[model samples]
Target: MSTLQNFDRRRITGPDKSLPPVYDSSPSAADPLASPEPAERAHRSPSSVRPIFLQTGLIPSASGSTYLEQSSQKLVCAVYGPRQQPKAAGAGYSDRGTLTVSLKFAPFSSSRRRAPNRDAEDRQLSLRVQAALEPAVRAETFPKAGVDVFLHVLESDGLDALVCGAVLAASTALADAGVELLGLVVGCSAAWVGGRTWLDPSEQEARGARGVMGLTCLPALGTVASVWQTGELGLEEVEQMADECRRACDELHHLAVKVLLESAKKRLGRS
Candidate 1:
């Protein structure tokens, strides 16, 4: 008998052998360039956001942590640091402590497989997250220390919404860790599509939209901390979309506060 170990059983032997190409059949798999304007323009009201679910003190090892979820997106944030800063070359002590943020998407968080290492998109989002939160945090109070916020995206439905959710979760974790702040930061996103503004656009909606706007605000302080926009739009259109995003952020802030209060009450009861 021929050597069985050398047999290539996995190879196709028949002349008629063929393989079908795979394709993504999910609802969000529509072509990004396909215009959604025609269908979305007729919709009167903006897209309603799914109910938010939040909890604090979920990670015992971290100084502070919070878990937040809405629709198909889920995120967990852990706040650490406000600890001693390592001396660096040409680095001098400043009046205000530094705030560092690391935003990561889990390997399995997306429809397609993603590598674990941080990518360019992750780096950019991290910078935006830091900027959005810096204005709200009382960094000067810590002097030479540094506060590190780590965000782990368990699932992601849309990029704009993902970043916005990270900001909210990080701020909540900071508060839970007892970090002083001028006010909590809330984040929201709006998409301008087919001459209509959609609040909290789904991944499918965002891909087909003309432009998207992200806004972060300190609701209690009545301040806009950061605004990010993608695609093209006139100044007037931008301002209008921003207003819509701000309103949504304010609503989210209220819900965040309620969750924190409930968590505090539960902790007190346990004690």
Candidate 2:
């Protein structure tokens, strides 16, 4: 046997992982990136959410595409499919189509550099996105086929907001692709900070949060698609968070509708 026969080509020579540094504001007396004081955060009310700048059909090559921005976090999603699903690997066949979501971050997306490949956080976020939008998609309409959504985080502020942004962008892209859907699914998040719930908390505000909750729903149908949360919360707190998130989802759903309508009008104008 050749001397190189046992070598695994896939392994990188050096460490292939990078992680974010623990962020602490207490030590920073003059660090410009220090977290703002409570008074400084007063600009945005507890009930208010960050302004969303969303656009659909942004990628001509994709069957559907969306670009989303909420403050410093930026995400783009491209949807392709109803294409053939791989059946050669004994993956078996399913009458219902599959919705596969992949969320990855740019190497420089966060303050700390990220790995080139999808990390655990990225995979988890992708799963959250897939779960949120799968219920809304009429997968049974296209049997033996699959729809794939790829989300890229060009930049990220808070982990909680990033997940919601990815879900929101993916859902819009699916709608833009003209996939049959029960209704548009919108995503929103809230963080329990300083003994209060704050909608759309930034990275700084969320770092010290007592809890974080992410919600996605079909607001028009008054149905929730997915709810993700972390940290200890009482039953009452959970309910309160859910109610707040749904209200925010309703607001976001209206925005999704407006974007889709405008995109359709533009397409018509072009044709």
lDDT tens readout by residue for model 1, 152-235: 988989998888899999999998999999989999898888787888876767877888989999999999999989988789
TM-score of 1: 0.85
232 Cα displacement, candidate 1 (Å): 1.5
**How many backbone clashes does every candidate have?**
0, 0
lDDT of 2 at 227: 87
Question: How many Å off is the CA of 73 in candidate 1?
Answer: 1.0
lDDT (Cα) of model 1:
0.85
TM agreement with the true structure for every prediction: 0.85, 0.85
The Cα local distance difference test for each model comes to: 0.85, 0.84
Best by lDDT: 1
Q: What TM-score, to 2 decimals, does candidate 2 have?
A: 0.85
Which 10 consecutive residues of model 1 have the lowest summed lDDT?
35-44
